[model samples]
Target: MLTKDELCIQKEKPNIKDISLELYKEFSEEILFNQIFVYYFTNGTTMRIEFREWRIYHMLAIQHINGKIGKDRFFSAIENGLTLSDFTINDSIKNRYKIYKERITMFLCMYSALKEANVFYLPSGKVQNTKNAKADYIVFSEIGSKGMNIGLMKSGEVFVPMTILISKPSNKMVYLEDAIPMEVERLEIINIPIKEKEQDSEQ
Candidate 1:
């Protein structure tokens, strides 16, 4: 059951509990006592969605960006899941999702690749140091997307649950804390889409 604070939602949070529960139920029937959803956020992060029962944490980064509460088709598509807006050869628009499955997969790979490259480049810590690198640095090249940022990953820091918030409007290359769910939502049956092509155009 969800609490009042969870339901209050202040027009700022997204009420995804119902959908989450539906997913949870499906998961339970498929696999006993399984209650979790995959969550994504700005910045490079992913986490096992939990049902702690709260409103603020119930919302996803997409909902926060799009002005939560809209019946528009675009949003309806997004709420389904944040997949890239791709039209298939069959002339069908891709299923929308709150999280981009392709993006998540690529992000994991890019993160690893960046770490390895950085470690090799700055083994002396003068060029780069994963533990304590200054944000003042910038990677200048026609490399990845302009918005892609290399954030600080600390030792013993549990990061999978954190959303990767890229502060673009701030005119800075970075990913910072936008919000943290006091309680993450849980669901029974989340129809995570079939894995699509590993790449999305326009990054």
Candidate 2:
């Protein structure tokens, strides 16, 4: 049984052979997960995506910056407005907006990947099972000794997961997993292709 928020391993298990020990050692260290731009590909199309900046937290920051939301009220909004109520942004976190933004973008990438795979994350973190349902997958970023760890989970098991290492900032597994390629003949930005300019050969 797979919950809508969860996913099973891909059918093409052949594509996911055990990573070499050398490769594993190479990425053993913590990689900075703060890359603002995420590159995604679908149906033979690739695009660069950036996270939307206008979030509730960003709004609170703006309010704080302008003195609209005072310290106590801003903290209240964070505690009440966000789902992860246990952890609120403190002064230490506030000073590191770049790191916070990176973390936010990481989740954005994870959600986008799950959506592309036709999997949905439930607002409530409860796992459920259905009969004869096509199993789906879950992608999540974990904070580890080595910055962020991206995991691919299937059927209560983790088949392919990687520690994001600064040595190799772009992990192909993050993009390639569960993406069914098609005959899409264009460079896509979030699935929309940019119009190209025609050249005059005679010039």
Worst 10 residues of 1 by lDDT: 50-59
Model 2 lDDT per residue over 80-148, tens place? 453222133565445544333333323323333323332222222222232221212223322222123
Give lDDT: candidate 1, residue 20: 40
Which residue pairs clash in candidate 2? 7-136, 7-137, 8-136, 30-146, 31-165, 31-166
TM per candidate comes to 0.22, 0.22
* C-alpha-based local distance difference test score of model 1: 0.27
Candidate 2 residue runs with Cα over 4 Å from true position: 1-91, 118-203
Tens-place lDDT per residue, model 1, 1-203, is 33322322222222343334333223222322222334332444443332211111222223333333342343344446633332221332223233422222222222222222221111222213233433221211112332333322222322112222222334432322231222223212243322321122113
Tell me the TM-score of model 1: 0.22
